[model samples]
Target: MKKTVHVVGAVIENDAQQILCAQRSPSMSLANLWEFPGGKIEAGETPQQALKREIMEELDCVIDVGDKVEDTTYEYENVIVRLETYKAKITEGAPIAKEHAQLIWKKRIELPALEWAAADIPAVEQLTK
Candidate 1:
């Protein structure tokens, strides 16, 4: 089987020390789950380039790619994702969920209450800590 490598980006804002999160679209595979905004890395694109494109397409915003926080690999029923998470800062535009159902800003302590994608569990834990 051919494994698909997907690069995912996580956007974080220091709102007095909190992070921004978006709810996944109901029609999406990981429906109703809360996640840091990101998407798959397309062919011929670097992970950073892919992240910038995905954020622009999904949130209609510009972000400054910060330090790479973590790289994780996880498996789903249909595909495997090599999720590359980064600590991102929004340079311009407000975040609107063009692809997601809703958006939210949460403190580190509140992260566990929101439903997160299975692959994101570890990432979430790390972020909250």
Candidate 2:
């Protein structure tokens, strides 16, 4: 049976209205692929809390998780994942890429041009619309 992994992502926007995107590390499962920043929702944590913690841990910054953007359950080649993405804004320091290979800020129109993770495609389509 496939375990359903619950995760959260942030559609973080900067002052320039550019959305933040992250590239997976070479060692990660989806290496070199672009994704919204976030991680799994650990035990006893709400989706919002998990997103905040993930952004802080993965990007080394703080964020105010706003309204949810997309909630999707996708079946990857291996694991099945439920990804909930929220609109967010940085409330503290700038994001520093410590785990990801790189970060980029992009306009909504440019979102579809990048190679986004399959699970993130729904959110990207939502953003681009």
Candidate 3:
């Protein structure tokens, strides 16, 4: 049976109303695809906690997580991904891509121009709508 990985993503929007997007590094599984910055939910941690920790680790920034944005379950070749995205705002420090190839802030309308990871598509669509 394929294992399911539950993950949280943050749709961080700045004062300019642009959303933060991260590009997966060459070494990452979904290399070169864009995604919201976040990671897997560790045991015993609430989704909010995992999101905070992940943003700090992956983006070197602190965020205030808000309402849930979207939830999607996608099956890949080797695993099933359950991704939950939430609205967020950076509270401390600017984002610096620590694990990704790069980071960009884009308007919701422009989000569809980039190739996104499959699991993140639903959230992107929601944000653009």
lDDT of each: 0.83, 0.95, 0.97
For all predicted structures, in order, the TM-scores are 0.92, 0.98, 0.99
Off by over 4 Å in 1: none
The sequence of per-residue lDDT tens digits that candidate 2 reaches over residues 15-128 is: 999999999989999899999999999999999999999999999899999998999999988899999999999999999999999999999999999998999999999998
Best by TM-score: 3
Which is the better candidate, 1 or 2, if ranked by TM-score? 2
Candidate 2 wrong stretches, greater than 4 Å: none
In angstroms, give how far residue 54 of model 3 lies from its true place: 0.3
Clashing pairs in 2: none
- Please rank every candidate by TM-score, starting with the best: 3, 2, 1
Clashing pairs in 3: none
Ranking by lDDT: 3, 2, 1
lDDT of 1 by residue, 1-129 (tens): 857768787757765678888888889888998888898888898888888889899989888888776788888888887888888888889888898899888888898999988777787888777
Q: What's the C-alpha lDDT at position 86 in model 3?
A: 95
